[model samples]
Target chain A: MAAPESGDGNNGAARMVTLISSDNTRFEVEAAAASLSQTLQLTILDGGGGGGDGIPLPNVDSATLSKVLEYCIKHAPAAANGGAPNATAVDRAELERFDNEFVNIDQSVLYSLIMAAHNLEIEGLQSLVAKKVADMIKGKSPMEIRRTLGFPDPTPEEQAEMNAHMLEYGWAYE
Target chain B: MAELLRQEAVEKVAEIEAQDSEGVHQEDRLSELPDDILMCILDRLAVLRDVARTSVLSKRWRHVVGLLTEITLSAADFESPVNGSKPTFDVVVQSNMDMVKAVTSILAHTSRRTIELLSLRFYLRDESIDIFRSVDHTMQNREVVKASFAVFPEMRDMVCTDDDMVIYGRRFLSFFYNYPRVFGGLKFLYISCVRLGKFDIANIFSTSIELEYLCLNNCDCGIRSLLQIEHPQLMGLKIICCAFEKVELNWLPKLQLWTYDSWMNSEDRYPLSFGYVPQPCNLRLINTGTTLHKTIKLSDFLDNAIIRQLNLDFQSGSVGDLKTRK
Candidate 1:
């Protein structure tokens, strides 16, 4: 496999490789993509072996990781395209559209995205998904937020305390 | 039978559309989220006043606003301060003060644990001396009444700037004392003020053990220990136009990123520490009118941050270790 050419100044020349998760799962991606995570970059650099032999990701499951890769794949385009060239209104609109569509998925898919982004250190993807959740959460009722996010119902005493705390968050929906 | 079948099919379609996804994992859900994600979500969160209004509806999100590490207050967020001199700005000083008071009161009740980042951006038209005074007053009254010590364990970046009186010399000392642990673990902190005392530097910096990116903007600070970096995990530090008798670089064991500029002569220049991490995170130093008499010794090892570039600018000839500025 060809070592990926990193036009960006930061990571230098990184190679494309195959990564294997715990359940014999495999992902063929550019080394630059894996290097999005500082932890993986350092580990690969410090290890100093071709290790092109599919780096094993025992902690990550296949389904969750594929979702993370979807985020990574979408983000890979933005990264390759030079990430929001000149922050113009139209450019921002395009990015906003991309971000919205990128994160619009089942709650379970969103959850997996959040977790995998964290594990993989895809900061942009994580933020997009989080802002998506936050947007849905804002102006929503606690029960509604809980229901939307799949959180379990609160105990009675917990509810009372929560009600008291809610008195402090100043905004409301009519 | 045919009519019943049609109704059943439509009802089934309705149920599928109405179904929500609510069975996802919760533990480590927030913690495992990337830092930027947390920042974005917190960014969208409403003010404490707005958040409290939600408590009447349900229990889960009542304290969620309080749990947020980012607290932002716009001048428009509050009514003008009570009985204050009319400041000469679109944002009334009274409004700024009221917002500060309301935020501090909420901070008073917010959880002291795991509160890592606190950002206060004020459009102040007045000197921020009283804003600090009120915080001091809160500290004094803390023991007598309900008080919780602020433990910002995960605080990284703090931006306290804009039109205001809060960014002053002695004030940051109080800020340092009130939240010593916060700065100790920070990655980026930017503060702008008029003056900086010798004691504030000697005392406040003693507690910043793991600072990474630091920028001091136009503060008339003493330069006695301008490079007294003790941070074990520090990666970057930026100091601009500050007073310094000598530049002393000591024991920055893991420091990889450094930005320092001092106009004072070599007599005031402090020596660079030895055997510190040869790894270069990112190092940028600017020479004002004055140049270094000698290239103070850097530990024998080359900076090994595996960096793609090195930017160093000086007068006349180039130092062997320093690369081009461009």
Candidate 2:
């Protein structure tokens, strides 16, 4: 595939890519934003997601894909600047606010986002979701953690196993 | 056509949900995640106790904890409560031993994993535990890329005697000698409230080949003994309230930032002499000592090295007649 012309336009006419979600939804976004995904970056760099042929992601549903793209589009500029060493405090603070708000979602959506971020190999998104999950698990006991993660009621066998594990490793809770 | 497409998509989602309902525990989404993803979640639980507490969550979580790549254990996490009173010496030693036991067990649990970061912060009071040996065992050939240690004494700096300094220094050196590979691969080292000999500090530089940052606080070699430092990879150095005659920066090619907070000497010339620092652009010199009555000329203090940023703070004393020549 022929690469796009260098510096095609001065009016910020960036190249675009289309991604097809598992639910057959089309998302047209800037190529730089889509490249935040290490998985998509190689494909896009090889001129794979150009023009009408969209990159099909079978693992990510349309909702989760939309959320992941929102994060990528917000963070692509900073990522392009090599972590934006020169980024103003105001700009960095704005992005931090966006990230804190973006991961504030329902439990099911959070899990889906985690899986999507992992499948796409998006480093920033992956860490963000992981940090959120970790915070939920921090300072929580075993039962609290189970409830926080929406784990179903334990069966008698599982309860016995949990009891045995707790009795065995009880020193950590101190 | 779009309406028909939406209908089919809704039906497919409903079908999947129906199939998931037939499973025994499909709602446990986290348990359903792959092992690597769970490890990522647990890795952010920086405190070792929190990471360990995840073991009782489920069998999958216990397995994931075994596969964690980063592990941080600190004695402060297990500090015994003193109820607003100063802790007894016995209490401190007991807590340190408790932490040591926990660290030993956890290190054994995750011995098989290829740990990328292993950090430890502990008081140098329990010599019987041999934390150095346990850490060396866990880190050997495991490709541990970054390791840091913050060693502290049980006594405060003001109360520490020369004998205490020598004892701590000896223990630290012996540990260093015993675990050469561990020291060689260390990325950061912070030692406080200990007196290191001139040769001991020199040996650290030679052995800790990969150390990029070092902080020495309330420590010294001897009374006004000249300390010469040379490191090929160290980028940042901080000497806070350290008692040294003159710290000579003999050769640090990659040094970028240096901070010397306080010294005891009242010499007319600057206590720090830069020899071959080529990359440093930021220099901070702070002192609250009465030795600041003397004048300091930046041109002579900098010794021909180009600096872009300089900060001088002499709290409660006048840094008399400061001069900076181009």
Candidate 3:
């Protein structure tokens, strides 16, 4: 098991691990960054993704794996500090800017990232994507949310069910 | 054999192309996400009403709205004549009933989980006693960490009226006395325009151990006895337009801010006194009457207390005597 090191100073010399996507693409990342994913953290601690053996994520495609890694690497330092009390305003602002731009992608890509984040159990990434989807759905009606998410037109039965539900909780619509 | 393989590959490509054209692969991804992720999305909605509205999205969402941990029920949400007209007495009564029904319905349907925060704001009338009882019933079994109960009459200014004020005050005290368990485990409490006597206040302090912030606005219960607030965990206290004879701050070590706003006709000679507030505190006094006797000095009120900031805004002529105490 790769035990967590002591002391607060996170300088260069951090351990690295290799992650393999479903497409068999291998990418090397800092162990600390990849450990943001709770699922990978345990495996990495078990010395599974150390040296020759790479962690295989069969559910994540190459394109989605890269994006997930991008978020983890950026958030790794702040997360390492345990919400670093000494973190300056500029550092937090820069991270906020990165997060805002990170989720800007096509709808299909967003869904792919959501799936990967959920599967990986990355807390920050899951919340970020969820918040983005919530923003898209806020103040939108049921049909609008479906349309925004690229859902096909509901069948007549589904439409009737939705209408009945809406009528029941009509005050919520108001 | 090579020709046959090429033909099969071409047919597969055409099938993929046809599926792409139809967009069938883009199935409701939002609903397809796991329950926990959808819950995360639902939790981000600021208002619980919006969260409830999501139930109509699909059959899967019908029960997800029940997962919200915070519920805020406001009487205004049920107000009729939605176009900003004055609500009649009948309308107000109807809205109060509807508000109670809505809260009960939501609580009944929601998953049995500890609510993080539950706020109820409504007008207190004789008819609303049942509503309060229903609310108490709903809250008794659940764990509510922070709760606020605000009762205001239909007319905003009617809070200061004597008869109406006393009626509301009596109701408020009786409700707390009857069902103290409904307000248990609250960290933040704000009561406005409710009458409270010494025992009522004592009951509140004794029941709510985790109380951090308490605001009593325009309450008429402190007229007879000295308002003694002796809470160990209370951090901030605001008393506005209350007719208290004297407010004695007793054993509140964590209190940081104290604001007392009095009416112009208030005759209480010493409105406030600090006994054991050790924290650096800011005391703000606004619109205090100008009836200080000639022998009383402003410094006498200070009593050599260590206050970080003291802001005294008195009636016009009252400043003449205070100028010498600087």
CAPRI grade of model 1: incorrect
Model 1 chain B — which ten-residue stretch has the worst lDDT?
B148-157
lDDT of each prediction vs. the true structure? 0.50, 0.77, 0.71
Worst 10 residues of 3 chain B by lDDT: B13-22
Q: What C-alpha RMSD does candidate 1 show over the true interface residues after superposing them?
A: 16.6
Alpha-carbon DockQ of candidate 1: 0.11
Residue A75 lDDT (model 3): 86
Q: Write the per-residue lDDT of candidate 1 for residues B1-326, one digit (tens) a residue.
A: 33343234223322222112244345225434444455456565565444544334332333444455544444445544546654443444555555555555545554443444444444322333344444444334332121122211011112333222124444556566665654454445566543555566656566765455556654545434343545565566666655554444456666666666644545433333333445544756566443445553332222323333555565634244533222
lDDT by residue for model 3 (B157-187), tens: 4435767677777877777677776656556
TM-score of 3: 0.75
Ordered list by DockQ, greatest first? 2, 3, 1
Q: Residue A26 of candidate 3: its Cα lDDT?
A: 96
Q: Which residues of candidate 2, in runs, are more than 4 Å off?
A: A1-113, A120-132, A150-171, B1-21, B26-29, B43-48, B80-91, B109-116, B127-130, B266-270, B291-298, B315-321
Residue B6 miss distance in model 2 (angstroms): 22
* Candidate 3 lDDT for residue B216: 79
Model 3: runs farther than 4 Å from truth?
A: A1-16, A30-32, A42-48, A73-102, A150-164, B1-32, B73-102, B125-135, B196-210, B222-233, B250-254, B263-268, B274-280, B292-309, B316-326
Which runs of model 1 end up more than 4 angstroms from their true locations? A1-14, A44-52, A80-82, A86-96, A168-174, B1-40, B46-70, B74-101, B110-134, B137-326
